[model samples]
Target chain A: MLENKDPNRTDLRELGEFGLIDHLTQGLTQSQPSTIKGVGDDAAVVDIGGKYLGITTDMLVEGVHFDLGYTPLKHLGYKAVVVNLSDVYAMNMQPTQVTVSLAVSNRFPLEALEELYSGIALASRIYGVDVVGGDTTSSNKGMILSITALGFGKPEKVAYRSGAKPNDLLVVSGDLGGAYLGLQVLKREHEVVKVNPAHQPDLGAYHYLVERQLKPEARKDVIALLEGLEVTPTSMIDISDGLSSEILHLCKSSGTGCRLYEDKIPLDPMVISTCEEFSLDATLVALSGGEDYELLFTIDQKDFPKVKGNPNLTVIGHMTDQGEGANLVSRSGSSIPLTAQGWNAFQGE
Target chain B: MLENKDPNRTDLRELGEFGLIDHLTQGLTQSQPSTIKGVGDDAAVVDIGGKYLGITTDMLVEGVHFDLGYTPLKHLGYKAVVVNLSDVYAMNMQPTQVTVSLAVSNRFPLEALEELYSGIALASRIYGVDVVGGDTTSSNKGMILSITALGFGKPEKVAYRSGAKPNDLLVVSGDLGGAYLGLQVLKREHEVVKVNPAHQPDLGAYHYLVERQLKPEARKDVIALLEGLEVTPTSMIDISDGLSSEILHLCKSSGTGCRLYEDKIPLDPMVISTCEEFSLDATLVALSGGEDYELLFTIDQKDFPKVKGNPNLTVIGHMTDQGEGANLVSRSGSSIPLTAQGWNAFQGE
Candidate 1:
């Protein structure tokens, strides 16, 4: 039996998500010769003979990650799979297979699960990954979905979070802040519906933001594009926890600092307009509003010519020596220290 | 944006766990050349060059799969990893890596999670598997643990559930029913403690059963023993959902029926005594008591000589023609049809 009244118990919120992970996994030695990298990357890299296998897992809880009041079961399932595939893609591997596990309460009917599975099936078909194996069980409350994605690549081509070097050009794929803005629109509409059951609010103006939040895509195409252009990222990570947080991750892992330009941060017109309507700073939203699911990487300065004119790729900044520290250059020309404002699940609601 | 008042919803309990999986994954098509087998097996088989890779996942939810009141955090963590590894071992593969994902509410303190992770670390060390990757998030209610295990084996040496043929001897590693009996003893003791909070039940008499319930091990040693003896099973599966349910799974996949001799069922002395004290039928307990975590396989009659006198294995039955149907040959010389009485998570508690 466990002691429920321990006086020495430390609150989980004190350490936050990343701190808890580090503290819990400290000194975990790997004995498998095939394990090339573990725990500290977007995906774990394992050597399967001559090739490299990338494995990663992600979990999404109903209340913490999404609200069924606005999020459909199909989209939730699709988003769950995409988020994990994004990790594999961040590792610069070709996504091949996934295992999906779900724990749901009795409130979810058979038809609801069917809807969820359909979205997973759609993602599998679109991404060309086989749904290999999984387990399903009942939970006492809301649904919890956990997905593990596996991908393969050449051992030499496998990218790690700790491979960045000073003077490398920092780049990101697609836009930022749209997914977070979309979530705001959905949550607002959900509150309105709760007060007025028959209300049907028009969302045409927020279409892009809503879609970005509900159906954000992983950057699988970016991996292929980089290969076609003959450019390999020195280090890469998926932007799930906002731009500033990811930049900090790359910096910490690679032992380098970065200088991100505020003007260079990509944002869709809808995201910009939504931020104005909500009276929020667009730059701050891009910096700390998580769940973008875009690939952020660094390329050698010499290789910049290959992606120079690519519309899908944007050069936002450059890596600096670790002693310089991570910072953002504001539009007013002042440099400010970058801090991780990423979503911490352990924080009290 | 979603309709919660749908009148056409079907209850999940209608189809049960296996039926739900079958229904959800009915038309999934695998386009990957490396995917040798997908779904409907203990673990998915993937061809990574000349070798086979095994991928499997399992989820454990609080109140459904386990209760923290009677289960120690360390044992819970260890059991979670062992359950997934059992599937890989059933496929005749050597587990090399695992990804453990946990979603816990703020109710769990940092110290509590450390105890859980310590158990997981111990299992990883003993099982010789690298803790490659995982995701941690906050759940709305209780804790949910999802683990994915990866293993490797020679393509030719890999065993499948569909490989059994007529006349193959059905063999099981270790004794049956102990784990189930162990759970019963724990539940009984738990009830006693609940009625009198200060009472500490002496469980010395039920030590073996309690250990079996609290710390069941996957038969990785049995896999090695089979290899050392040069015995390749015609078919193999792990007994997680009790003997009858697992036997049915093998029969369904292999397209054969089996003649399971009730008298031949192996039971430990403690299991039998515990069953007697509990006023439960030992045969029924062995038939439907789940979570045994023992390897069950079919071997050719010629290879039976290799394991004939092995203390670790017992030949309890023989595969029969599909027309024979699955039956239990009772010690009284009467035949009875086998029914799956495995624990279905969807069933009402």
Candidate 2:
């Protein structure tokens, strides 16, 4: 009954998450006058009289999004809220409230839940967002967390994914690759512990990377910094599914192309050292490693001086004409096509 | 470090969903000025310019909330959206936008997800709400659907569970017990089918009951009807956890007591007949068998004349002073205290 039906019954793995979402929501027509902008953005925008309210939702499944062996319940709870808040911040809005819904198995003790809630409370307090509402229910397997963040900003100040133009500078906040590398470290340690319970592998050297994986914070500070600098991004998004995937999203939504310089990609010293230890390319890790929770945006060239040499900001690339296609300028000065090989949840871990 | 922690870690089973949520959110403080109301209400209320926006979220897990063997993906999708919208309506607000997030197992085909989205599209069309944004991911087990609904209403017109006063007449829209009874029938049929592949139990006589279970509609019409009649509810809630549980919620939140007349409870002929067939007490089914999706609200005694003879509404009870606890006056003239032995997700199916 669907127009997009495949006679051979295509696997979700073939379409991937983004392609599946696009395929499913192909013809969705928004009818509400209050809906200023709908799908295909970091967050949906609603016209609420004096300002625009940005609404975003995210779902984190247990086995898919997390592994409880190393991930503390507290950090999991905090990270869940931060991820949703990142989407709101991507819209240049300060999250005012959030509703968290969970489907948890009975295997969790009340103490464990208290730990989770404590982390949630900490995130709410630290971010200045209220835990407004939530539903708690039972799950048959591992836990699932779904969070919805609501934020507001003046209509003129809010950024959208579809506002980029040619020559706009593409900038990113903080660094990348650390969270993904942290997950690798945790996984490696988990395997080691499974094989030899008495062996305690020192994780001190990878503390920064491990912490980024376990307790990454959203770049709410980036939003504030940009505002203080009087810089309005032409387009914006949060890098959750790797920098490459997010840049592709911005380029596709804005009908533009981009050229990202490999040397310009921000990577912490720890990230670089760890990449070498693992024999992985640092630039590739920075490009496709996900869960950075960093802000990626494009700014008009005229505002470049304001953000130039800013400690937290990195000028990584610039938007280009759609016909040029998105490419990464390697350190050796060769242009290579950028593909969105980000995390595909449908693909078994 | 939690004050409520037991020397022996308390199992989640001991507290159940509601008790656990209450226990976890004990000290959650709302510091955001935009957050006018938080936590306990059907929907969180946020002041947005001239109106109050109601935000609520619900999560439906496959084995916990539905059985794929009997439930059509389309109906499940529609029901998921409707249930969330019901919360917004319970706050006496008109839902204008919704964000649906799903985590489905790879077992589901593209067509299956299409069917689900089709149902969501249908719900949005029927309810006049916009499908704004969402996230889709993979789950390890069965499908999970989480929806967040956004709605708005004038500040003065918004109904809160805490607004009920003594002497206000408690009323309900449509009938109850049908949805719960429908579940009983579906569960019976599911068991029958499990035992014999060829067995197809006749369900023609229980059409309404089965439909109520599979595809219950939210009472957006009730809000419209009340508006048309110029009747504003002093307190309101949607019947999801049975009448007894809802009444207790209203009473506790409003700091009052309630008197529900067993004889005055509205039940369809189908509900009564099915209850008899199942040898279940019709009154108990109406009182504690939840998922009716009907609006239960209280109106001031002064405005009783407006809804007194309305065919769509039935005045089943009235508010009382807090000193007198909530009770149900039965046909035998016995006053039985109401208990909230409603669905407890953590208690297991």
Candidate 3:
């Protein structure tokens, strides 16, 4: 039991997600010379002579991150590793090893674990990262997965969130809003199935969106492409918490502002159709919808010629001075303030 | 929903803890040049030129690792960090940074998390390790804490479980069985409280044991002391799953045998008295009771004199030829085979 030392217990929601993290981590000191970067980054950078080692961790709780009714165990495991690797890639580093810790209840049998591990093995094989170590134990409820990914890159090559400069071109890899729309479809179908177990909903139309939600891949190819094109990003981050939130993080950390052009925002045709079907605004969905797992980065204006015609790359915005603030310039010529509607599992959403 | 592809499903308990890990990790290949060790060590070693970086992870699930009714959140936080650090210490390395991830239910408020972080911060300050990064999210059920500790040591200074040789002196740091006895005392008191809420249990008699269970510290001192004594253990492991289990692990990994003297096992007077009070065998309790968090190591016979007459170090046994097998020489002059009845959380015990 614990003694209530504080008479007024502050609710977690009152602090929100980022506020809570900042409050708890304030005044924390790094005591290691190897620790080049501690918190407030895509991954903590450890100086290891020839290159810096980027370390990052993420936890996925069942029911909060996924619904078992629709999520396959193999996909859950694969996505768990991939999401953490995305953070490493966000640092512009090559992931080398990972530690996967799992806590599961008795409901999962050995075969279920094998399927989960098979997915982890598949990810490791494809990502060229070694499964170095982990801890497996029993949980009181459902499954919880925590993955820590380690990566490395030269000091000059690795990107940080605070490196964006004024006038830097903002770029994003792939389309957005698909994962969120896919989740909405899955939830709707789940409700339908609950009402009638015999009902088999048609999902062929939303195949691409659903796949983006279930099996999102890290932009390892983008990193390699940048190297081949000799274009290094000034600032980079993985788009896990929606575009608005991630861009705000870059702007806040770099002491700059951004103006995203709504006309240039990339969206797959399927994403637009799904948004229309669901009666959701495509622009709003693209701005606030999370779990895209795409790479959002900023590059110098000099590198524009290298990435201008690349099909995988989209120039959506540019950095501005700190006084301008983060905004989205609409196609109608109206400026809208960007807000972070990032998904917070703590709010029980 | 998931379709059962396998008709026959095996329970996790059938495979036991180690068997399940072995089955899941079988045929896993390491392809990274930076990865020196994977899967089967106290910590995974990564090549970093001047020194090797050791990374290890451990997860603690509520209701499985600790009972919140008897465990304080602050102590739980401290113990969670310490247990993972013990793994890093087991490799004979100095821990530098740690990443902590917690999946907690909404039952806990911001103040509760602040208390938990306070304990974590205290441990980091005391151990001289930096809290580099962590993920804090919501869990569907109870709390789950996962910690990844990073450390570094010279290649020659790092000790692995497979490095012990025949005739090496088997040594253990501190006393065993106190933490297990401490848990027993707490559980007994909890039962009393459940029967009558007004009952004030007298815990003064089991103060040492209670403290051991509530706040077990890793052997950071032993690592420093060994260095001071100019002693490099041939093989080392932390006694997390009882003395017999750890001895067996060392023997199994090193491909050797061991002979432990029953009288040589260091035990506090309180452990002997408490074992008598509980009508339990003290020798058996010391042999099989887990969570001691002491260091179990092997050193060359030439280093015996250096460790001899040291109160903190106990020469419990010696490594023998592979064919000899692992045995415990009882005070009655009988040879008893050691078995690993170590705590398996997956068994729901």
Candidate 4:
């Protein structure tokens, strides 16, 4: 009875990841009274008794998300859990538990799976969350990991992407572009190893960059910091897909515009030096390079004093009226419209 | 530093599915006070205020879990959600929400995904659960679906697999063996289609079996019926890995043995007749057939009167002392040990 009604089949690549999710989930309406937020958010919020529970899930596919040739199974497991927890942290929630599900082919031995789970367990212990449950099964090809993170937050303390108001200060925790550059270093090393099997390359100089890519720490501490400072972000999102894409998400959801100052964007000395060596623009990398796993948020102008001059946070820009549009004010005083040049799995594959 | 400690790579098949999960999660311990149960349960139970929340996840891999040649995308999507909801129901919790994640190769078009989401939405609507959040990405080969179901129940009313005591009556909802028989018919028809293309084989006679395989429903109605009858099960589980395997799990968790009566095993007329047609043993099929999505539970002897003569449930056996061991009494009066002949994704590949 479920025949293809349309004569022409539309290619999935025609609409990118965000567009595809939006198209498919357009008709779904929440019927459960407990479901506070369903789709179109970092995490779905549900009211369990008086507490607000945030639930988020993420999937990592082999070849699509990672390559096992260089990526250790343990790090892959740790990063997979961190990716989901980042979403919960983005909502200003304290993560309590996670459910990890995996699909692996016969090529993965029992020892390999054990190594993967060790990393998962380590992450669970470090983050103070319980590994409550999961499902493991055989896949047709390589490994696929899907994790669901559950966290809780007070009703008033929870943050959302749609809560930003015009004139709020845009804030970010930690530096950007390191993770993306780290991946570049790994990919280059992998290519070298492919050509010469016995090549022993010293990566001492790129230790920081490689670690950023391999083992990203989700900003659970930032959520706690915000609570300690008595500052609630007006809007918040995790920087999984570059700064440009995340800024657009907050602006679109909050029905506002933003002016991201180029000079104010946070960057480490290592990122600048590495970008110079690679002949890449540091600002462009920070704007378009993804997988930072840092929190990008906005707070009311009155709360600026709380985060001002804080090393953990950078005041990158400020929100503006919808008519002003989202733009990047370059150091040279040029107004450039921000575009999502972040990694799109569907495109350029 | 995450090097393989063992020189010999042990194949995953040596451990099997259940063994792999147990071995990997062996070192994990619950530190969260909210986490009531973890790892080894139908669903992990967490305390949210005074309410109990149950979380469960399941993964379905193409080629391994299903063959898309005959399986419709819509049915696959519907069944994925049902599989997870069944776990929540096994904990005697009311499913509140679900997150459905998908990883598909470029072979699937937008229409295919839309068809799948339609099924997901349909199932969500019917089950009274909100479609929360999910992740969709590209896969290396075939499609992979992972679903997480969230449910809620009263603290005192939640059932666990370890609560069964000796003398408690074992019961199951719905008949067994239909889904397994349905798969056999489909496989036979698939072979016929391969041999003679364009051959129109009638499937009208096997409609019930095929439906049982393609669109089996979770026991939500049974949960409500038990509540209406004021009968709360002491221990419960879902029949996903067949009666033999589920009975063993209940026995192992509760430290009790079970005496399953073969004559009391429920079977449909179609199932019995089809077993004869296929030259298979009906009792064996019923015992080892998986994917029934039926609820199996143990109730106190005092509560037997509440469920007695109920068409939705059948008293099949009773829990016994741990020394007795789990055994099934044959119709001819022979007590045979119950072996788990259910599908093992890791073995026989």
Native contacts conserved, per model: 0.81, 0.83, 0.74, 0.82
Q: Provide the overall lDDT of each model, using Cα atoms, as 2-decimal numbers.
A: 0.92, 0.91, 0.90, 0.91
Residue-level lDDT tens digits of model 3 in A1-349: 3434465777676777788788888857777888888888999998877889999999888888888988888888899999999999999999999998888777787888888998899899899999999988888788888999999899999999999999999999999998899889988998999999999989889999888888899999999999999999999999998999999999999999999999999999998888888999999888889999999999999999999989999999999998999999999989988988887666743
lDDT of 4 at A161: 98
How well is each residue in A109-131 modelled by candidate 1, as lDDT tens digits?
A: 88889899999999999999999
Per-residue CA lDDT of model 3 for B12-111, tens digit only, reads 7777777777888885777888899998889999987788999999988888888988888888888888988999999999998999888877667787
Q: TM-score, each model?
A: 0.99, 0.97, 0.97, 0.98
What value of lDDT does candidate 2 attain over all alpha carbons? 0.91
Ordering by DockQ: 1, 4, 3, 2
> Which stretches of model 4 miss by more than 4 angstroms?
A1-7, B1-7
Cα TM-score of candidate 4: 0.98
Give DockQ per model, in order: 0.75, 0.62, 0.67, 0.68
lDDT score for candidate 1 against the true structure: 0.92
Which structure is stronger by lDDT: 1 or 3? 1
- Expressed as tens digits, the lDDT of each residue in B1-349 for candidate 2 is 2333565978788887788889988867788988898888899999987889999999999888898888889999899999999999999999999998999887777878999999999999999999999999999887999999999999999999999999999999999999999999988998999999799789898999989988999998899999999999999999999999999999999999989999999999998888889999999999889999999999999888899888889999999999999999999989999999678887754
Docking class of 3: medium
